[model samples]
Target: MHEKHKSHQVSGAHKWLKRSVAHKMFDRVPVVPDNFTIGETNDFLKTHIHEFETINYIYITDDTKKLKGILSVKDLFRKNPDVPVLLQAHQDLVVIYPETEQREAASLALRHNIKAVPVVDHEGKFLGAVTGDQILEILNREFREDVLRKAGIRRSHMMMDNILEIPLWTGIVHRLPWLLVGLGGGIVAAGLIARFEEILATNLILAAFIPLIVYIADAVGTQLEAFVIRDFSISRKLNFGKYFLKQFILVGTIGLILGGLIATVTNVLYPDSRIAFIIGIAVLGAVLSSLLTGLLIPFLFRNLRLDPANASGPIATILQDILSILIYFAIASRLLS
Candidate 1:
């Protein structure tokens, strides 16, 4: 009788609250009162264990249903059954409110190294437990959602299992919006490339290296975007400037190494031409440009109250492509022409 699964089906208006810990919680979790002797509790579970969703941890409450402490099932078995359940329970508890967001609940569960997070009401009354199974589901859903958002797939409803089943128009509506942005960016890139026609004509070899520049820049930017999205998801409140600085130093060092290799390779291939030195500097500039674009775009998106994921794949990659072109030709114009 104590395992009364509360069915607070918050429909329509507050349907979004389905993401809260309350919605995922199992109210049929085994809960005992403060005064139950271990022997009595053992006896009760022996007959009624099938009623509860999980016996991972048994919650204890006072007469008024205020949560007091919790006892692990292992401790329950270790203690003398004649002792009061409260005496065997750990009084120092980690509790979260029913209204806590799913991410926060996951965070709390992780921080405390607990498999289940107990939910309480305003007055600290024991409500229910969001068990390990539910927590796993929450984490899996959030990870997939983050991946889709970062890939600029705007359709949040489509699941991996049914990816092929989504109608053609629905698929395009979600995916094409971001690709259209990329298309506009490509037009701007074409215009930028055309603007440097004089440099390209003077040093035809520079045109040959265009794909190399764009590919390297896009690669660097995609790597940085991975780091940004990871930090944004895990630790939003932590200072981003610190993270970006470490990334800057790391990227700058690698850019120098890669630049040296590009110079060495170019000099080996075209020993007499100033084009070798020119391409090296251009590649270095492209790397740094990519790093800045990757870092700033996500930060800007977050500040604008948008999902940081929207700043990564299409937008960052397109900007890097354009910057790589401008950087490559600007260097060629100065040194090769």
Candidate 2:
């Protein structure tokens, strides 16, 4: 009989794992109708509190089973016994729908700093509560998924599955798509450089700064991409216009400082004021353009329902390189000519 019960329990857990929070996995903790007075609730809790997995908060509902408020156990014990539960209950409730994804429900709880989240039906009827223990499990699972995704691993693998156990061909298949796209971007970058061949030939010294411009711009872009990826993962409602304006101003200031340093150094070394001036302006433009590209591309990807991290790697690098080259040579051509 014990073995049979254990088998049933395992099957129930597996079924819950594959289903939503409404699937009887959540805790149906103590609930009191809002009409109950403090005295009545106190008597009810004394008898029934032990039945719940957690008695931190008691859900308050109306006759129709609609969620009305919540009362902390601490407040319940301290309040006047004759006071109505409604007077002492916290009416500003944070609730989740039963159909909500378990991970999303967990995220909401974490965001609001709530110990447990109440589940409600479409009509706002109380269902149950997703307790803190279940939330911990959901958060752990999501953390593993996020780490694997950032490492470019496939989601088909289980969180506890050993990476070394995966077949080499399966790993290759998961990684090959991005690599091919990166190869194509490299080809495009090569084409862009070839188009600027005349500027390179006329001012051979300009070729010397190509790697410098690309490297600095790539570095700045990578930093911005990292910030965007972290921020967007937590909150999707970022104000893009305000964010873009702030980044532009910040990058512009950095560009001016960098440009001045380059100008001072090149003016002393080159002995040609015109060439030094052109290089300084080109540096400023390249850096600003790279910063904007980095800030905007991630937002664009996010809007298109693609992972912004995809903007962080080869795609961002190649774009910054190509744009930096174009901006540098354009300034050089106008000033040096």
Candidate 3:
């Protein structure tokens, strides 16, 4: 198999890779905001612990630069340093950016053996801090969410039932744009049906199978889109060759199997072998196109820095339905003519 073709396959680790590492990994950058600061080591320690609650370190910063000083409970209350401990007293302060990858951040933290690192902006001003515990928690939560997403399961139940607890309104807030896009997709599908009015009028069976064909294609597209979005989101680097090959193989196999089954079933049930074969071929072609659409559409949206899932979901399925109809009719015309 061509290396590029491996990405589309449903076998082995490909699906798992798409589901696990790609879907659920930490991506959000820790930020303390420009206004973040610890006034003085001792005073800040007293107040910050009360605010953030058992915080690891007090970040010392000013309007321009992050002064290198951090005071933990142990440093402040336990064996205090023999010198005066001020905001800029300590010479070492580790800082990270908001856009740093989670894995890389974790690795850095581990290397230094530090519990917490302050986050700073480009100008060296402290934004906030990320603790070792927080990083691990975020990664674990993301892992669960990713697994659930791949299974077509809601994540609310997995970690804390937040998915279950959050009202549908929350999802609606995110899904509203996609839902509108779905409406537009419906319009496009309707247009395709209208264009094929003559064919549907002559063969009612064609109309009967159209919905099923479109729905299956849409489902496949949704699954592929989810996987691709997760991959792009977690790892800014596009592992294009691998994903492409996997999707192609998996989608192609599904198309072949479905097409063959439809052809066989229709030939057995209906009186006309001619219509059955044509419909089978058309359905198969539509399905394959749908899968490809699902894979590519989200990838493109992500490339453009858009929310791939929200932007691609309704549009991909709608376009797939339109394409399916067109392909189905084109094949039908050639065979029936």
- Which predicted model would earn the best lDDT? 1
Error of 3 at 17 (Å): 28
Error of 3 at 74 (Å): 19
Clashes in model 2: which pairs? none
Order of all candidates by TM-score, from best down to worst? 1, 2, 3
All models, RMSD in angstroms? 3.6, 5.6, 14.9
* Model 2 per-residue lDDT at 318: 69
lDDT of 3 by residue, 1-337 (tens): 0011222211232333332222222112221222333333445445433334225554444445554456555565554434344432355666666656454455456668777655555776554556656667655765665544434333344444455768897755533654576688778768877877787788878877777677777777777776776666655676787878887888888888888898889888887898888867876787788655777766776778654554453456567778887788778767766
Q: Compared with the true structure, what per-residue lDDT tens digits does model 1 show for residues 71-161?
A: 8887788889899999989889888777777877886788799989888878999878889988898889878887776666764643674
Q: State residue 91's C-alpha deviation in candidate 1, in Å.
A: 5.4
Name the lDDT value of residue 157 in candidate 3: 41
- Compared with the true structure, the alpha-carbon lDDT of candidate 2 equals 0.75
> In candidate 1, which residue ranges exceed 4 Å CA deviation?
1-3, 6-18, 34-41, 62-68, 80-95, 107-113, 121-125, 156-167, 272-276
Number of clashes recorded per candidate: 0, 0, 17
Per-candidate TM-scores read 0.81, 0.71, 0.54
Better of 1 and 2 by TM-score: 1
Q: Show where candidate 3 strays beyond 4 Å.
A: 1-97, 101-180
**lDDT, candidates in the order shown:** 0.80, 0.75, 0.60
Q: Return the TM-score for candidate 1, rounded to 2 decimals.
A: 0.81
